[model samples]
Target: MQVLTIISGVVGIATSGTEVWHGIYTLPLPVMIVALLWTGARTREFFAER
Candidate 1:
């Protein structure tokens, strides 16, 4: 959970770059969305260990 936040922060910072891909500071919303989707709310507690 914490790691996901950190990853998002990093991506947000990178997305705020003025010269990102030679484009004016663009928010990496697409990447952020992807990150959020990939790491959902599922956790160890949600699974039953056999």
Candidate 2:
């Protein structure tokens, strides 16, 4: 959930650069990738905890 939120936020900022600095484009892709992997890790951990 957090990962999706972050991705959406980054995408929003990237698409609408007026909100965040235009230079933010350099970071979102990497951050989004890590967020995706983190989400997967947390999801697996959740299942493992059960």
Candidate 3:
């Protein structure tokens, strides 16, 4: 789950950045936001387990 979240976040950021570079910036924003939130939650959980 943790690894998946991290990968998802990375992919989301990359996709968003690519889209923005092409001057298309509306669609990927929500995806990037969700990915960031998910990654943060997962990372927090992971650290709390240690």
Using lDDT as the measure, which candidate wins? 2
Per-residue lDDT tens digits for candidate 3, residues 1-50, read 54555455566667776544333333356557666876876778977855
Candidate 3 yields a Cα-based lDDT of 0.58
Candidate 3 stretches with Cα past 4 Å from truth are 18-50
Q: Rank the candidates by lDDT, best first.
A: 2, 3, 1
Cα lDDT of model 2 by residue, 1-50, tens digit: 54565666678776885766643544566677776776886768877955
lDDT of 1 by residue, 1-50 (tens): 54564565666667866544433133355456656666655643356376
Q: RMSD in Å for candidate 1, one decimal? A: 7.1
lDDT agreement with native, every candidate: 0.54, 0.66, 0.58
TM-score-based ranking, best first? 2, 3, 1
TM-score of 2: 0.35
TM-score list, all predictions: 0.32, 0.35, 0.33
**Candidate 1: stretches off by over 4 Å:** 17-50
